[model samples]
Target: MTDHADLLELAVEVAREAAALVTERRRAGVEVADTKTSPTDVVTEVDHAAEELIRDRLLAARPDDGIVGEEGDDTPSTSGVTWVVDPIDGTVNFLYGIPQYAISIAAKEGDEVVAGVVLDVTKGEAFTATRGGGAHLDGRPVRVRDVVPLEHRLVITGFSYQRETRVKQAAAIARLLGRVRDVRRLGSAALDLCYVACGRADAYVEEGLNEWDLAAGGLVVEEAGGRWAQRPGVGGKRLVLASPAGGFDDFVAAVEGCGFTAS
Candidate 1:
């Protein structure tokens, strides 16, 4: 059996190492080498470099483990463990020198994520969790906020890079705006989820995110006493809704009431 605690420790270590590399490269200056999906979606040489470093370290520590990174091909594993990684979760923000980007890494057994970590590179904060082990920030235990009423809760969300999808997303946000205390759009999904996990925010909703984007942060939120659900969205996309226990039902209802569907 895999030791989830050990896996969590490895995740935090690898994530911090990757974050260091990303931070160093950003400080030294690197160019945006290419775009993916749309012009608004971008990749930098540092992204690739950081991913390579992460892959190397992971494989070095556990040669039998598989890896699925945002910037590279998947490597199969025979040990029943797969590492899901996003070397730079907010590439656009990284390119623009914004401080909100992060390095996200998660360890999965089958379909369940057993351990995860999200390192806010600029802020030097590490959010981590293990299956059933609760969540932590910089070595201190953290839990979701206990806000009860949905309307009083602060919510965070993100936009899709595709213009058409973003248009619809904006509309949905507009409908939800009046129901919540306020809404924020942080460029990084991983960070947004961590914010919900650590009581920085009450909830988060976003559509069109890949597994790598949610694998780590989702686990953190759940372990921090939060509820998260991925719902079906327009064009076969996935929408993620996460909130504290008190407002979970109302939040989900409000999301669907605003014309969003949960899977």
Candidate 2:
């Protein structure tokens, strides 16, 4: 039988190790390794190094499992399981010396994510979850916050690297701003999802997040009693929208009303 909790343990371990490596490298300073999609969408040497380290450690522990990562080519699955990883989820923040970046890792059995972890590098906090198991932060059980009114809920979001897409997002956000208590652009999707999971924020939404970016943190949100959904947004990129259960429907209506789903 596939042990989801066991997979969670392995993911947490690998994520922590990667976090340590990332922190050490950040202290030495960062250099731009390349750009993807646009000049502002940056990747650093530390990102590559951290991903390599994570791949090595994970493969060493589970040789037959497939691996997919932000910075590395996909390894096909042979053991009916795969790992989706984002060695550094907020690379732009890392490059700029911000402390919000994280190492996110998740285990999937077939198409379903069975286990996951998101490690905050600078904060040393690990958010973890397993299918059928509740979510946790540093071993403490966590759940989304209780009822919050529409006008008082704090929402977090991120913009796409594409300029045209961002222009649309800006307009959507402007519409959303009046409906919520406030908004935050934290530059880290993984952390943003975890924040929603743990009640740090009432909700989150973003477009253009890849599988590696959503796998771990999405699982965390579901396990924390929150609801998340993705839909085709502007330019056909995914628009991930999530909120605590108490106000999820209200939140979705607000998002759609804000023109987030308009192509």
| Winning candidate number (lDDT) | 2
Give stretches of model 2 more than 4 Å off. none
* Candidate models: Cα lDDT each: 0.90, 0.92
**Candidate 1: what lDDT?**
0.90
**Clash count, one per candidate:** 3, 0
> Where is the poorest 10-residue window by lDDT in model 2?
229-238
Top TM-score: which candidate number?
2
User: Which regions of candidate 1 deviate over 4 angstroms?
Assistant: none
Question: Tens digit of lDDT per residue, candidate 1, span 102-162?
Answer: 9999999988999999999999999999999889999899999987687888999888788
Q: What tens digits encode model 2's per-residue C-alpha lDDT throughout 18-120?
A: 8889988988988999999899999999999999999999899999999999998999989999999999999999988888999999999999999999999
- Work out candidate 1's RMSD over C-alphas: 1.4
Inter-residue clash pairs, candidate 1: 231-262, 231-263, 232-263
